[model samples]
Target: MQTIRLTDLIAAIEGTAGPMGDASRSRRPGADPDSAAEHPTASGAVAKESLTRTGDRAAKEGRAPSGQGESLPVPRIVTDSRQVQPGDVFWALRGERLDGHAFVGDAVQRGARVCVVDADRVTECKGPAAEAVLIQVDDTLTALQRLAGWYRCRLATSVIAVTGSVGKTTTREMIQAVLSAGRRVIRSPRNYNNQIGVPLSLLAIEPHHELAVLELAASHSGEIAALAELVRPHVGVVTGVAPDGDSSNPSISGDGRYVAFESSDRK
Candidate 1:
């Protein structure tokens, strides 16, 4: 996993960073000067101590920190409070069945270094363990997507987006298997092809990954376009289209290499 500084993450999600309790008072050695200038709030003694403490806590919990740095390293981005680990960033997402806001306190208690929550529900996240920072955003889901898109643009990896009604997942897996022989490839986990899953998969990309094969799925109009905008794949592949499947054409960008299979049963 790539090391994501707290300041860059705040900027990427267009979120407001809040004070991080008492740990933000001391300084950690070898802090990045350029990163401090980018976001003053995360600079000097405050950021240094906060990050050091986070790393220390992770070590005590038997989890090794990803890197030794002045800047805080977010080891992982988790949506489930149960999976929260020291130095992880917990993104609160609202779903139809369960609201993540309800778990904000639980996440903080579990050693999450940061909590990204909707601005409107910020109050619900108050009174946490105080060791974590709060990032208030307009919408958690949209912010997640935006951050993933921003991160993708910074990577050197070539992305291949696979979308179609019936064979999207299989196509993505096949591509990953073939590419893995020669390159460091990352693929969508399981059938993760929807809005939430797509962004999560993209965020899981590591700095060493040479290629990414993502499966894109849509249950409604405009979803494919939205996912495509975030992916901006170097190559787009459509397996086959069916009348009952998503007919929305994927809008590919950034190189525009595309391949589509013509369906003989097209109505």
Candidate 2:
């Protein structure tokens, strides 16, 4: 029926610009100043449709321009085949026990507009879904991360990322509730603070959103740092520091304006 087109929402990004993070910037800054290209870990190279436009830049790169010409609204991004819809982009993520590639056909049958798959599985990407855009990348998970990073750089929304050994979710919720009183606030959903969840949370940001409070969770080293590069928050809050467990929560804030960390002494 009715959809919120990027053409309409894109105006919100016109004059707003700031340094988000290196992870969020486009890999290749082309002749067209507005075009953004993504470099997924699947391959060191850019994805065929990663370019926002389909002009000389696309021709020079020998790929079709994707994000530029489509007046049709870009649909929501989803990982599950069951959630696939006519306009949604289905990411076929591979899990240890369950391979998302197996459900590609199901996603196509359900009317997915784009299907992201592993580069090695190009042969399997056939039939009805073939008509939809097939973005072949080195890794679907990394592609998801890159896509979120690319989208984040285009907006001027203020980001506050929360991470710690404990209480990250509670802190994030409290921040969102307080901020929502005056601003249009966006926050991480449930425990969506990991690799997949963090990217999805960033993707949910709209042009109208003034603040984004993302709760980052980590059980190991470097996980928070990796996620921080994606968020590049204006404020980073670490709920607590674990004396026993290794915590990367503080490191996840990057070079932001403010970073709040708890003392090692547990009160």
Candidate 3:
């Protein structure tokens, strides 16, 4: 099997550098740079892994880093407060060393347009800049997943899923190469072919993508179903499975695949 890796230039960023807001800049011509920096949200975001949006898959895999001339707008999905910049949006994810909710005041002072917070914390927070919009979510992680799923459904192009006992990655690569001839195909990074990887792929999908081909692997039962629930691939092809009940997608595809409870353990 060929080793699949993504180039740093194309890997999505989960956090950002803090830029001082105008208010802080006005405090002094050359105020303390550290003082100017503020956290991204009331709480830092979920984790860097949880900062991705639903349909913005990263491209440029396998390509060397190129110097981009202009600054790209910071996506609002960062999971850390320290990554917050004045103009960026912040998602307050509940996690270690930070609760996105705990940093709302800093985010507002630093210039966050909106803050996503746990609905449970809505009544518990207060700050001077009461103007910041607080969007309520039942569970940040689940909400993020649902948002990605919704965004995935908006595409009008072809969506393909590939599964196999052997050479799943190689087959996916071949399929990607063949489809890249004329279409703007968005293949999952490496083998982001499972439950978590599928959603990550969907988060990276762009508005202009012409195709999405996900490479799937299953070492345990029900794993495909977990991936299937999130990816909902219109087309899927499984490679092979072990007879010791170590692999199958019975519930995922029924037609051929087996689903099991231990499917989400891929690292």
Candidate 4:
């Protein structure tokens, strides 16, 4: 018996293409090559793996992707105005004492399409970005979590969940690093290891991703468990453990780290 290498198997399974190096073939013996990719980013987003079904690609499905209405502009969710993008849903989270509700108007003026405000004093900062959807949640963080939960329910990729006082980012990066080095892997970027961070990270997961690595972090008790429930990792990896008293789970390098994950029952 003989065993074919997995790489060969994968190539056979998905098919492959070679570079079309013949300039004459492309130019049709006379066409100009300068017409290629003039305004590269004009309307082109990074080409992710295509997830559109053949039928969906050919014809309109029963329902539109973003509902019956026209596709809405991208919302700039800002924890701070500095990170604001045009047409974003500004998530006005509260700080020590300063509230996001204060800058709601300013964010709208700056090009935010909508505002998701914490419901303590949003009334004071109404108007402007007036066309924005003013959703009222008891806590902004909770609302963010709920939105992410909803998003997870809609995904099909096997989610890789990560959480630790430290090294969560490093581990998550490692997993994504290994997966994406050769494949179109979609994973969270950096230490977005918090409640809000996870959801924001999810937004980065385009339909094109075949895999995703989600980073979760918490300082207080039950933080890991709660985030775990939200992500619903079929496989879990805990990078390390910190002192029980102090709420710091630092990430480190090397395979020599304390990690816990679920496994299938023994045969």
Candidate 5:
């Protein structure tokens, strides 16, 4: 996987990066104040400085930086505010039950260096969030998926997507076990096969991973197809057709190679 910088992530998600309080401002040492005000920090110096400080702290604590860079590495990405550590990037995702926007201040208080939020909900990020860098996107979930897809393209890892209504987990485990013998393999953890889970799984892929076996699951139509676009698997597998009307077969007509496996109780 290639190193993802703050600029790279902003571009990937099509987000606008906001300043991290006054520190994000770039003021020349001897330049006129008015002239310095005219020039915003578009050179990524703020990003570099913020990440460098965070990276230094993480290093002192014996923790690795999340994403790699030339001078300053990007911080770890976290969705749950409780999981956030100093210098982590907190993505505020609005789920069906809980709204992550409500916890922006909490994440910031916990030492998140960056907060990614929906453009419309920027006002929800108050207090401590003002101290952190803000990345505003149209939709947080979509931006996350886009980021995952962008990151996936930079990896040399070969992906294998598995989809089915039944036996998907079993099949995924089987494939992972078989591939683990000689390859640095990673697979979807537990039942991480949904929209959010799939992207999280893809983001978990490291540069050293040779093969990734990801399970794709869907409770509605077109979900599998959407995920497949991000996964862009080198090999696609179907363990069985959906028992319900909604099909679990992913569209594999693109560059992905297809394979079908059938299972029946009568056999």
Candidate 6:
């Protein structure tokens, strides 16, 4: 249904909000803004239509509506071949146990509109799959993170990031329900609090949302920092610190507006 423009995504990943960025209300501009928009690049090329969705969104829904040429809406993103649908972007992730690269052909066969691959594995996408738009990145994981960050920066909605060893999810849910009681709110779905999961959550944000409450979970070093860099929350919340809780506190944008929580157990 809704899609972010390819040009805007390029500018965001590059850390430069370009002309298209100024046009779209969302950080990741949608194709509907300028269907005729064209961007010729070697690494990340845009076809007649320039739009993409987060993997979570695509998997949760069925095939998207189709349009003609430049008027075409951006496709949804899917990491699994089984979820691939017409006008979908398949992110080829390389995990320790399995490599997504192996399924590029399968994705294309299933009607994927685009595919993200590593710089070294471009050759893996061949035959009919080559017809789909190819987005090459130094690393798919990093690309996914940057794209999420790009989308996060474009939002005018207030962002509330919560992190802790325990009760992070519970705290987020409570905050979301209370805020949503009055405002149009969007919060992280389920326990999506990791590198890949977080990005998908961010990408799920739509234009009408007024508030965003994202829950952050960190088990290793730099995880919180990475989330902070991407979200740059206006309000940072830290629940009670448990033994397995995230020691790294959420960082704010330092725009002179922020909120924090202590033990919440006032004696």
Whole-model Cα lDDT per candidate? 0.61, 0.57, 0.46, 0.47, 0.60, 0.57
- lDDT of candidate 5 at residue 5, scale 0 to 100: 65
Better of 4 and 6 by lDDT: 6
Instruction: Put down candidate 1 lDDT per residue, 1-267, tens digits, no spaces.
Output: 477777677656542333211111112112222211121110111111112224444422223234343456676888888777877888777755566778888988888877777777776575663456666666666767667766766777788888876677778889999999999999988756666677777788888998889897665444566567667777878786555322343322221123221221111
Runs with alpha carbons beyond 4 Å of true place in candidate 4 = 1-76, 243-267
Error of 5 at 125 (Å): 0.5
User: Could you give the C-alpha RMSD of every candidate to the true structure, in order shown?
Assistant: 13.2, 9.9, 16.2, 18.8, 14.3, 11.4
Top candidate by lDDT: 1
TM value for model 2? 0.70
- True lDDT of residue 225, candidate 4: 53
TM-score, per-candidate, Cα-based: 0.71, 0.70, 0.50, 0.62, 0.70, 0.69
Q: Against the correct fold, how does model 5 do in TM-score?
A: 0.70
lDDT of 1 at 100: 75
lDDT of 5 at 111: 87
As for candidate 1, its clashing pairs are none
Cα deviation of 187, candidate 4, in Å: 2.4
Runs in model 2 with CA error above 4 Å?
Answer: 1-45, 48-73, 245-267
In terms of TM-score, which candidate is stronger, 2 or 4?
2
Residue-level lDDT for 212 in candidate 2: 87
Best by TM-score: 1
Candidate rank order under lDDT: 1, 5, 2, 6, 4, 3
How many residue pairs in model 5 have overlapping backbones?
Answer: 1
Query: Which 10-residue window in model 2 sums to the lowest lDDT?
Result: 34-43
Candidate 5, residue 131: lDDT = 65
Listed per model in order, the count of residue pairs whose N, CA or C atoms clash below 3 Å is 0, 2, 34, 12, 1, 4
Model 5 lDDT, residue 197, Cα: 70
